[model samples]
Target: MVSLVCTLRSHQDDVNCCAFSGALLATCSADKSICVYSARDFSELPFSPLSGHGYGVHYCCFSACGQYLASCSTDATTVVWSMDTGEIEAVLEHPGRSPVRVCAFSPDSSFLVSGGSDGTIALWDFTSRTLLRTGAVTDTSIVACSFTPCAQLFITGSTYGDLRLWDLNMNHLHAEKNAHDLGVSCCQFAPQIMKGTDGCVQFRLASCGQDSLVKIWIVSLLSAAGIKMQLAHTLTGQSAPILSCAYSADGQMLVSGSVDKTVTVYQANEGVLLYTLNQHDRYVTACAFSPTAPLIATGSMDKTVNIWMLEDGSGAQGKSLPDEAASVLSSGGRKSSGHSRLMVSEWSEEDVLAWLREEGLEAVIDMFKSNNIDGEELLSLTKETLSSELHIESLGLRCKVMKKIEELKMAPVSNGTPDEYLCPITREIMKDPVIAADGYSYEREAIESWINTKSRTSPMTNLPLQTTLLTPNRTLKMAILRWTTCQ
Candidate 1:
């Protein structure tokens, strides 16, 4: 059973949005203020009521690190506020001076996208705090946006009843017009990346609209086959327009808030309604699932935010943490923070930050975040680069940073290697690769870490693994050695 843990009435006006990071929760409202609360006891932080917006705040989102909060307003700007000090870090103006309706940080936190009332979308380089590009759809306000887990693409849903996909370069990859009958109020991609039996990368996206329906779409990306998004299922649990939808950290469950003052939770993949919560006294405007817990926060026009805890044994605790923290978890995690799902050459700026924190090099986290150091940039980091580009004053820290980068480069498939030689868990060329019970070969350290933390299950199939024993993939290792020598 879902139990209400607490109700926050800090906002004198309607609560427009609520977001949670690993340790904190933030809610914004028409009161033109943002409230910060510690997830532990639901107490407002001393520095809360962050008040930089000139007009009613419409939305607020936390960065992946939980260090910063971004909020947009009717005043035509999106402000990034430091959670540590409750101070405004940057004020990004929308391109057309139009009221900004929503803003979202990319999965890696390297980019920020803000959609405005005038149908304009501005993409910003978060590190540099500069506008990279802008796009728009005529006659429609962009109301919702979400980045895919891979960080390579994003989807924006608008009042035109369309969902448009775009790449980092702001190129329109695809568009699904009439995705919703009336208009889309919210859209979010599931955190997990699934691989089908056919080898195509599959991503699930949940979208809700004014039509009182929630949709699950399967987006498939193939190297040569192009991109295809197919409607997988539709949920009609809500009786009125759903305003917000969110996927649980595991991507197994979905929760949405509606105009009918109800929150419906569903089994995402199977499209089964799991629970219907009616604690809100007015139209529910926002909903979010905690990234590190089985808790959910739903906000309503009643000017309150209700926190609900998923009771133990509800299967909510079985899932691993979100993708960013999965590898760093003690069990069912990577061997070290140096390890990640993407190849070292493909790591994003936030990936670098996570590794730094895991490696106890938090001193340089800000330095790396400021420079937007991604996987390729990570591979290229050197003592000289750290000192020169990153301005690290301490020689020891520079040396440590360089050493970690080198370790990252040597950890997995560094670059210029065939994908076949890579471990599915760590995406690194396996030096001591072993075949698991699922007939998949993974690096010894990587697979062991995963098995220790997660249940004895196949990473690819999510099926029960017959055994923990992993046989050495000597032939594949030999092939990798040969390929390395040739390189």
Candidate 2:
């Protein structure tokens, strides 16, 4: 229920901010940089950290699909990164005297929102980083904002106890409310459409303020019509100012970190405390839970990133704790860089054939040679013979067959033997034969048998000899049988 799973110490100064998606966690520091770690192994993943900010980093958050991350700095810039390749997608800068404090991604990942010290909010297109809208605050600086689950609207909170809802499609202010009596430190969009399991389709917003109060609000159509949403509950356990708050994916758990140097996990529907984590020596600045994992990662002013997990979750009960020193992937094996097993199953027959073609004729030759045959000579002979027959342009296939016979006659054989042999007419082996002898100098029977195996059983005339023989006395005779109609 309460344990430090892993600790990352790459940052040199106070690591005051962190963010987690389904599989990754990123932390920001007063060292003016950020480091992202993998949720699977707790080791560093490949990411190019952006560090051109003049001041220290403050906060970071990932998009829904885990493809994009937004990090804000006191240097007045918010940098967007491509999470998959760890490349900077865009750099957002404000024209006024505002230092960017925190940033968040739209649920659909099409836009980004940032809060600045000048009490203004800026919206940037996800791809172009071009400003879409800018809204000025009334009294205090806006510190945080979150988009609804559908990304149609967003809510921004200021230090002067103000919360404003902006309609993204209309590019105008939708609603405003006094969420707290003091500075609102952080705010988040609840995963549910309503606070309770009712038919109401609304969004709940969780905010922590300088009053040490954690408040929840319902942003439904009923509430937008000037009817205030009922405050579901308020958690009052933390003695210091609450700095961060987030809801679990299932909306069953709520986690909050504070200047009180402690982070508390609470039941979402009920305000009862489920667990309390107290590992930080200094104030805990931010905390986040991986949506698909049982992990919880936090950054503290003590200059370290701590990861924890629930006791009953898989890999937390009986599994070994992750060693921070281990590699990101399993060691000493071929890592599959692309397609998985399920991907291969979905490939079509055409895809398989195309893959084979990419292997080329060289692979085919290798396969043929594996059977102890000269595949190169066989292919070359076939090509040349086909070309010659086609060049002659014969109508019947007889000429091509004759050409094949000549090729077989001229082909060099092994053991220095001549290609054409004088076969024995009566036996399977060669021997010395007399002039009138029915025997031959070679195995005519075997050759005739081999040639007959390839015959089509067509009517015979003065057909080409399937085999030929020569006697010991040098008499030569074609093995062809002359079939004639005797009348």
Error of 1 at 111 (Å): 0.6
The sequence of per-residue lDDT tens digits that candidate 1 reaches over residues 296-342 is 99999877888877765654422322323212212111133333445
Q: lDDT per prediction?
A: 0.82, 0.62
lDDT of 2 by residue, 97-167 (tens): 35677788887889888887667788888767799888777546778788888787888888777777787
In angstroms, how far off is 460's CA in candidate 1?
48
The local lDDT score (0 to 100) that residue 94 gets in candidate 2 is 64
Off by over 4 Å in 1: 314-487
What TM-score does each of the candidates earn? Answer: 0.65, 0.61
TM-score of 2: 0.61
lDDT score of residue 70 within candidate 2: 82
